[model samples]
Target: MAQNAHGGSRPGVQPVALAAAGILLLVGVLGFVPGITTDYAAMRFAGRHSEAMLLGLFQVSVLLNILHLSSGLVGLALARRIAGARAFLAVGGALYLGLWLYGFFIHRGSVANFIPVNDADTWLHLAIGFGMLACGLLISGQVGTGGRLDTPIDRP
Candidate 1:
């Protein structure tokens, strides 16, 4: 197996990062599609005034879509290395958690709602945050002999 610069074979971390990146990229693209994003014409560059909702559920603005695209690109770039992939998942997860909290606390239509996150977005952020964090911490390890030790299931 090819070893990454981190001196370990690329294991579960890369795939998790790639999956997350692909989702982000797909979401960003979907946000721009007319039927997929309801009230498409009402989409604004940024701010709570944007009336667009992805799948008629999550509020989305042009700025939010761009952020998703950027995050996907970053994930793709970082997935090249084991350490980078771990960092992407962990740090990205933390950021998503923070976004969830921000969305939950901020009143809609307020200046603080610049990201314009809705209830759907808030809950989705929570899920993504915990999911990413779990993937980052639980899945990381070297492949083969250098990886985590596995115990026999039948061992008492």
Candidate 2:
């Protein structure tokens, strides 16, 4: 097997993790853009009062964007190895699930919603959480040596 820059086998790299990381990084960066993130001038450091919305859908703040960027960075760093990538997805997915549930208890436009999630964000979190978890559990070893999905084409 060919080794990558991270000293891991090229096939060990997880595509799902990379895609997740890329998405997060893109979203994070987009949050800072004025047009992409509406009400850019109203974005708060970390609070529900922030009026900024990414793609005019999901509410965003400086802190939330930072969190996304950080998560994406972690995913990228971990994607070099199969085990590390799976751990990242599993743990990150759980955290997103927790965030999703947390959004339920938070009242709209209340200080308690420091994470500043709206209904759109809440449902999106559910989808994202489930997706990440499924990818972690079911897709974990697909890219690694003799992975569960791997079958020798030369075999009779």
Winner by TM-score: 1
Listed in order, each prediction's TM-score against the native is 0.85, 0.84
Clashes within 3 Å, all models in order? 0, 0
lDDT of each residue in 1-156, candidate 2, tens digit only:
444447786433388888888998998899999999999999999898899999999999999899889999999999888888898888889888888998877898777899889999889888888888878887636544654443598567
lDDT of 2 at 104: 70
lDDT of candidate model 2 versus the reference: 0.84
Model 1: per-residue lDDT, tens digit, 1-156? 446567876547788889998898899999999999999999999999999999999999999999888888999999888888888898999988999999999999799899889999999999988888888887744643254545698467
Choose the strongest candidate by lDDT: 1
Stretches > 4 Å off in candidate 2: 1-13, 142-144, 147-156
